[model samples]
Target: MRTRRTRAATAGIGAAALAAAASGAVLPATSAAEPARQQPPPGCETDCEKVFDLSLPYDVRFTGWRDDSAPGGRSVLAYYIGDELHDSRELPDRGVQDAECGWDGDAQRCAVTYYTGAHSTGALSALLTADRGIEETDSVRGGAPGATLRQLDGNGRPDVALRQSTYDPNYADAPRYWETYLEFEGKFVRTGCGAPEQQPSPAPTEPLYGSCAYY
Candidate 1:
């Protein structure tokens, strides 16, 4: 793999828009054999901190964590496929959130959402990839409450949903969400990131990023 510096996008642009103009890198199509669908290694709880050793065709490690100062604001989720180094991003003033990762079989499934934040001058790119890279405009506006690594579609494949501020050209201020499924034959599809039209958060009692029926 031809490597480049790890650069963040300018926090409010689409993947194609920013990647075409910015410095971050994207992996090219691979002819390598597809790894089998395998579950995440045991002992992984939500927002896990340990290195998830993939132990597969490609050596990879998935790490997830939220910064201590503001809790889940400055969240850091990263993948070190072999040997790489990078930095900590700012917390979104209101929107944006931490990164999430897991296993969708032999692939490492991970997600990252973007928004226009007081602290986010980086890029506005959404990335979802594991067996095959699924980054197709994963950006959003309302921040951390919108991105998640969980089952959205009723399937066994790992899915990620991210809400972008603008998805359809027909409307403005439209909160568009998309769910990307990583499945057999790398059969990937798009769906809404998910949420009701009301105020964010199911109730004051639940955690900000907690799993609510409304989402």
Candidate 2:
């Protein structure tokens, strides 16, 4: 009777263990903890300036910095939406000349113009939406003075117009104009629709306004 009672107790313990396993109440002896995620380095900590701001039903801000910690000063542009960082771009030069943000149709467009030395300049533009975030970015070899939006293709959505200038050593006094038109089908694409007219004889140093010839 003692042996029978001992066997009954052992069987009851086994049943309890099986029930715990079926109910997912059993745990392993050890578990590996997940690693923490790493974040990108901060864009600016000191010598920061608030360069651009726009209220498109949301708080949008653009801040910049001229970081001198490196060999040469680094130009940094950080974009924020509703106090949260959304995007950033960096350039190694004299710093940004201009930064602007505006609404273009259903998307919000932001642009930055930075000096590239020798009186030459470059621009960076981005297209973003409130829900989808940044959709695309374009780099152009020009200043932001002539950047504009127009309905070039008649697609109901506005297209982007970027202007650039070319100078000839012989005609240093005059600069030739070039315009790039970008249309959005699914993404921003060069339409190659607007080509500048032939440079007039003895081009004027001042900007010559003309129409684009669509090919």
Q: Which of the numbered candidates is closest to the native, going by highest lDDT?
A: 2
**How does model 1 fare in lDDT?**
0.33
Candidate 2 local lDDT, 53-123, one digit each (tens): 33332334444455555554557655445445566555665456555444454344655555554445555
TM-score of each: 0.32, 0.46
Candidate 2: misplaced stretches above 4 Å?
A: 1-41, 64-73, 102-107, 129-136, 143-166, 170-174, 178-215
RMSD of each: 14.8, 21.3
CA lDDT of each prediction against the hidden true structure: 0.33, 0.44
Highest TM-score among the candidates is held by which one? Answer: 2
Error of 2 at 56 (Å): 3.2
lDDT of 1 by residue, 35-148 (tens): 343222222224433222222123433333333344334333333333432222222332233334333333334444433444221223323333223332433333233444
Q: Alpha-carbon error at 127 in model 1, in Å?
A: 8.5
